[model samples]
Target: MTDTRVAVIGGGVIGLSIAYHLAEAGVETTLLERGALGSGASRATADVVRSYFAGNPVSSALAVRSLEAYRAFPVRPGTDLPLRQVGYLVLFSAPEQVAAFEADLPAQRRAGVDVRLIGVEEARERNPLLGDLPLLAAAWSPQAYVSDTAAIVTAYAEAARRSGATLLTGRPVSRIDSAAGRVFTEDGGELTAEAVICAAGAWSPALVRGAGVDLPMTAPIEQELLVTDPLPPGTPEIPCTLHAASGLLSRTRGDRLLVGMGYPGPDREAWRREVAERFAETYPGLAELDLHPAVTGLRDASPDRRAFIGHLPGPPAFLYATGFSGHGLCNAPAAGELVRDLYLDQDPGIDMTAFAVGRQRTG
Candidate 1:
């Protein structure tokens, strides 16, 4: 019989982080994953970490804490958090776009996001790749950086194991008896715990449903394309650039530029073309570069675009840490810490009402 104090169902970065925090705090924790670690959203992350959320101060604060954790991540053999401090540049092409971002600048700044508004000329000076693309303004997050998602997940898993947490891979959890604090696996295996955390990302809603809890979550497919430069030396390294006019992104990793967007459409061909055309229009300097196949992943999105943390109503100790939208990578560290404090029944030092289960969605 396998029993632990807390059972975390998911092996993504968020789950691993939660297990690590809980176990490190002397909570008997066990994390079960259906496949290898980071096989889900973590594997398909855009690999960018930034603390600039337009209108969400809570998310920005979480991101700041997460970034701090990444900088202070324990370094050991096979567990290195490689960070590329290329920063992030958000371009605004329209007046309304600029105004909306400007309105949120104060909130983001108060949340410890080192962001500021810059004029088009200054923005172009920072990134010459903008070419002749018109820009109204830009949000510059100089401290934002990119890191490898798989590396962070593996590092946290190791840290959790070192802290005496049981990490199980290929253990597909079929269902959970939340009221009973028991989890059943597809291979006819069963385990019990005092609490169960449904951090399964896009696969969480179904699992929570079996426990009679209908999470307001949706699984949306998001994709990023890898564009390779034939000559690496000639490639101009650019910040993680996002065009606010359109949800298009481009950032550099070695010789390749990662371009991606979330296009809610039935035709994937149209999506790819849009990504290509947008990148070309935004960065005309590298328009002719080689475009590789698009990489895809699922996001567990909530209505407010913020995550739903904290435990559910009544009994069985069912805690939820899913619905991160697209901020999972940047917010996992703080999310883990928050979940840990919640499970321990201690103050997490952050505003719990912001991420409370039944709180009003202001955004």
Candidate 2:
């Protein structure tokens, strides 16, 4: 039995971030990935970095703290992550949503999000490209920003390696015998560690089951993304804009425009087509532009659509950090800090009771 202090399963952003934190804290850590790091939903993410959640205090608070951690990373100034502090503009296409947006503003302000509810004329002035679309109202938060998730994950992996964490790739964990303190790999290798963390994203439920725990999680309704060919020169750099009417969000990424839409079920291919069709309808400006092929990937989801984090119920040494739904990209840094605290028995800085794995479920 190869004795390691901690074993982290899954090499997505959440796992890599936690591994980096553990190694930085002087823990002996080994990260096992079924595939290359950042190859899963982490890379497929739309990179929406915002804290303007409605009616979810835990999520809003997490986003607030996580945004701070994200801004503290050296990757912002010197690395390729290109963390840009472009604000988010949530537009309401329907008149009824105006009140909903207004109702959400006070809570957003309470969470310390720099959000302001503005009139339709002000919203159009903010984005001239929005053009004659009859928007009733909008909310703008200057604190919101987007990051290069691929670069962020790479930074975590490199930082973890530098801090002495061993990263193993191409090794799918087949069986997790937590009672024996050993995880068996498909290639017949066994990893023995004092503690094990499951960060397997959409595949987390199966991994937990292998270890004799039934987690209340499911394969997420896959999200779809489309990238447009670079916009014509002189087009305004659009802040991340969300159309509440259709659940479509669009942002500027270098020269190309990145657009995303939420899907309803497990059919990834169907969702991609739906998003592409909706994108054209929602933004008539993009009606002529040829939308690049759609790409679909799974986001680990919980029944309540919040993350499932904290120690697992069956084993004291096993932990869970999965089910970020589709917001893992923005929450990665905060997750790292939380996991580090959990492993070290330190106070988690933020109250994460709502994200606990054993929380009472109504549905």
Candidate 3:
């Protein structure tokens, strides 16, 4: 049997953040990590923070709240978890796409997103690096920012530990006994708790299935990121930019340039080579870019690109907060708050009906 009152499966940012909040709320929480904390997708996150979603009110609200939390959160003495307001510039290459972005601006403004639509001349005026390209328009948001996700996870973990939470790393849970309120690890020891939260990122489905719960989640695609060698002189300290046409997001990290591209399905090997080739071919400025060894990490994607959060249908003591797709890092803080609220039988702050796991799939 477990000694703690709550057992949180997974010690990544989501799990750690939840554990920290729960522990602070005076609940006896134990976090289990298969590997070291922050070693999962959280570690590999590009740390882009923006609230310009495709007019999804819930997601836009959550992003806004999370951004505020990061800004208000005090850095842990010597850490860099505070928001770096580098802004985000989304570029459109086609006239139709520019019209779409222009349409999106009104809703984004209504959602309190500090965004502005700029033309190619203004875009070049702000960022002189757009070398005479045929850009149609750009969306600029000064509120967009980036942060060190690993450092944030570390701070949360440390804070949780200080708040009486037990963190066990390198311990993979082999099985979960929901009715018995116990978790059996691969190491042959079992821990029991009053409730269990499965926050396992990509492996969340496997864990929930182990508890006889068939959660609607899958690890379909893996994202790849490339970091260019130091930016050449004269390159302005540009904000994190996304090429809507190419589906690429590039940001400046100190001297190097961090670039990311999204591809469908799980083709890590293919993506790594393709990203390297595409980076050189598309961004001519990065033609000689030293493609820092590409890394692949899984994203827990659901049929709908939203998270599967809330109580599971089966065991009363079991809960789930997974299927964040690739937006978990940006939504971690608000998610943690929601998990804490759920555990305490309070409102989850946001109307989570749409994100409920019990919702019927349209297709």
| Model 3 accuracy (lDDT, Cα) | 0.76
RMSD of 2: 2.7
User: What is the Cα root-mean-square deviation between model 3 and the actual structure?
Assistant: 2.8
Q: Residue 14 CA error for candidate 3 (Å)?
A: 0.5
lDDT of 1 by residue, 1-363 (tens): 438889999999899999999998999999999999988778777788888877777889999999988888854223557888988888988998888887888888888999988999888877777878777789888877888887788788888999999999999999998888899999999998888998999888889876677767765655445555553466678898888878887787766877777644588777777777877887776778767764666667877778888775435588989888888999999999999988888889988778865565453
Better of 2 and 3 by lDDT: 2
Could you tell me the lDDT of residue 31 within candidate 3? 92
Clashes of each: 0, 0, 3
* Residue 20 CA displacement from its true place in model 2, Å: 0.6
When sorted by TM-score, best at the front, the candidate numbers are 1, 2, 3
Best by lDDT: 1
Q: How accurate locally is residue 193 in candidate 1, as Cα lDDT from 0 to 100?
A: 82
Per-model lDDT = 0.82, 0.78, 0.76
Question: Which segments of model 3 are wrong by more than 4 Å?
Answer: 75-82, 99-110, 210-212, 263-273, 276-282, 312-316, 358-363
In model 2, which runs have C-alpha deviations exceeding 4 angstroms? Answer: 75-80, 264-277, 312-316, 358-363
Q: Each model's RMSD to truth, in Å? A: 2.2, 2.7, 2.8
lDDT of 2 by residue, 1-363 (tens): 447989999999999989999998999999999888987788777776788675555667678877877777765322445667778888887867777767766777777777888888877777666746667788787877877787788888988998899999998988787776688899999898888898988888887876666778865555567888778887778888888777888888778788877764656567667776777776667666656744666678887668888774334388879888877877777888898898788899766677876676532
Measured by TM-score, how close is model 3 to the native structure? 0.89
lDDT tens per residue, model 3, 1-363: 448888999988889889988998999999999998987777667888777665454566677777777776774212346577787787778888777777766767766678778877877666555554668788777877878877788888888998899999999988887877888899998888888999988888877876666777754566667788888876777788777766777777878878788863456567667766656654676677676744556667776667777764333378878887777877788888988898888887667777776566532
